[model samples]
Target: MRIGVVTFPGSLDDRDAGRAVRVAGGEAVALWHGDADLHGVDAVVLPGGFSYGDYLRCGAIARFAPVMQPLVDAARGGLPVLGICNGFQTLCESHLLPGALIRNDHRKFVCRDQRLRVESTATAWTSGYEQGQEIVVPLKNGEGGFVADQRTLDELEAEGRVVVRYLDDNPNGSYRDIAGITNARGNVVGLMPHPEHAVESLTGPTTDGLGFFTSVLEGLIRA
Candidate 1:
C-alpha cells in the first residue's frame, strides 16, 4: 500500500508520519502543500505541526493549501485519511470531521503520554484495534480541546462515531473525553494524539501506536 504524507509549511511531523508508514510495511509518498495532486496514493495522512505558524487559528491557513482541496474530495469519496494533532485542526477547518479544537481549558500547552481507549473499531484507520483496548501514545498540543454542539455530540455518541476516548484523565478538556473521531462514512479520522510517535518502542513510550498503521494495511487487504 502507498500512503501519502502531506507536508505543509511549518509541518514538523510529516517525515515521522512517512517513517511510520514505512514501518507499517507500506510505501511512503511525499506530498507537498503547494501541489494539488495526491500522486495516486491509496491513503493520506495529514501530519502534525505548527502549520503557517498557527496564524489566526491552528490549521486555519493550512486548510486552504492547494493539496487540501483534492484531499477533501478524495476523503469524502471513501479515501482513508488520518489527521493527527494539528492535522486534526485542519480536518475540522476543512469540515471533513465535525467539532473544533480549541485552547486547552487550563490555558497552557500540554505534552505527555496519554492513555486512550479504543471506542470503535469500525473505521478503516481503527480496524486493527479491539473495542475497549487501552493504549498509550504521546499527546501534545495547546489547542487540543474538542468541542461540538450538544446535538452533534449526542449524534456522535449514539452512532458510535466516537472512535477513541481518553482514559483516566482528559488531557485537553475534550468534550466527553473524546480523543478521536471518524466521519459518518468511517473513512476519515482525526485525533490530537501523536500515534506516529509511539510506533517504535526504542523511540517512544510504547509500540501500541503501530496498530493504527497496521490496522489500515489490514483494511486494505480485506478490501
Candidate 2:
C-alpha cells in the first residue's frame, strides 16, 4: 500500500511518519504541502509540526494550503486520513473533525509517554487493537487540550467515535480524557499522541504504536 506523508513548511515529524509507514510494510510517499496532487496514494498522514510556525493558531494557516483542498475532498470520499498532534489541529480547522485543541490547562509544553486505552477499533488506523486494550505512546504538545460543546461531546461518546482515551493521567486536560477520535465513517482519525514516535522500541518508549500503522495497511489490503 502506498501511504502519503505530507510535509508542510515546518513539519517536524514527516520523516518519522514516513518511516513508520515503511516499517509497517507500506510504501511511503513524500507529499508536499503546496501540491494538490495526492499521487494516487491509498492513504495519507498529516504529521505533527509547527506549520507556518504555528501562525494564526495551531493549524489555522496550514488549512488554507493548496494541498489541503484535495486532501479534504479525498477524506470526505472515505479515504483513510490520520492526523497527529498539530495535524489533529489542522483536521479540526479543516472541519474534517470536530472540536478544537486549545492551550494546555497548565499553560506549558508537555512531553511524555502517555498511556491510553483503545476505545474503538472500528477506524482504519485502529483496527489492529482490541477494544479496551492499553498502550503507551509519546505525547508532546503545547496547545493539546481538546474541547467542544456538550452536545458534540455527548454525540461523540454516543456514536462510539471516541477511538482512544487517556489512561491513568490526562496530560493535556482533553475532555473526557480523549487522546484520539475517529470520524463517523471511521476512515478519518485525529490523534494527539505521536504513534510514529512509538513504532520502534529502539528509539521509542515501546513498540505498541505499530498497531496503528499495521491496522491501516491490513485494511487497505482487505479492501
Candidate 3:
C-alpha cells in the first residue's frame, strides 16, 4: 500500500499524484529523479509535467535519470507503475511501453475532461473498472498522439494490451484512440490523461479516476 511518486526536475504534478495515492488509502512516498532508491514502495507513479522542460522531445532527457533505471527493472518484475501525461512519454522513451507520443495532430496543447472506456479490466491498474465502463479524467498535453508500426499495433490488439480507449472522439489523434495501455505482464500502465487530477470532486472531472489508484492497492493485496 505504499505508492511512490517520482519527481523529476520541472515535474509539475508529482504533488498531486502523491495526494491521489494518499486519498486512495495508501502511503505516499516522494521520490526524486536524482535518487536511485525506491524506498521499498510497493508501487510507483511517474507523474505528469514538462520534465527537463521538454527540451529535446517530451520525455527524451528525463528517461536517463537515476530513478528510472530501477523503475524499469521493478516494473518488469511485476511492480505496478502508472505513468501519466509526460510520464507516459517517459515510459515510451524508457522502452517499458511501446510506441511514441507525437505532437498533437492539431499541433497544439489540448486540455479537457476526456471520457474514456475501459477496454481491458484485467490489468493491475484497471481492475476496479468493469469492461466497457466509462470514466472521465483530465488530459492535458501537446505530445499526446500515439503512433507505432502496423505490426506492433496488431500485436497490441491481439494481446489485449490496450487498456483504455477514447469514448466519443479521439482527443489528440492517437491511433485507434488509445487512451492507455499496459505492458504484456499487465503490471505496468501508461496513459496521457491526468487521473490524479480527477481524484477529487471539486475539480469536476468525476470520481472515476480513484479506481485507478484503488485498483493497484487491491491488486497488490490480492497478490
TM-score of each: 0.99, 0.99, 0.98
Writing each residue's lDDT as its tens digit, candidate 1 over 100-219 gives 999999999999999999999999888989999999999999999999999999999999999999998798899999999999999999999999999998999998888888888888
Clash pairs detected, candidate 3:
none
On lDDT, the stronger of 1 and 2 is 2
lDDT of 3 by residue, 138-220 (tens): 88988999999999889999999999898887888999899889899998899998889988998756988899999999888
Model 3 scores a TM of 0.98
Ranking by TM-score: 2, 1, 3
lDDT of 3: 0.91
How many clashing residue pairs appear in each of the predictions shown?
A: 0, 0, 0
Runs in model 1 with CA error above 4 Å? none
lDDT of each: 0.94, 0.95, 0.91
Pick by TM-score: 1 or 3, better one: 1
Give candidate 3 misplaced runs (Cα > 4 Å).
none
Off by over 4 Å in 2: none
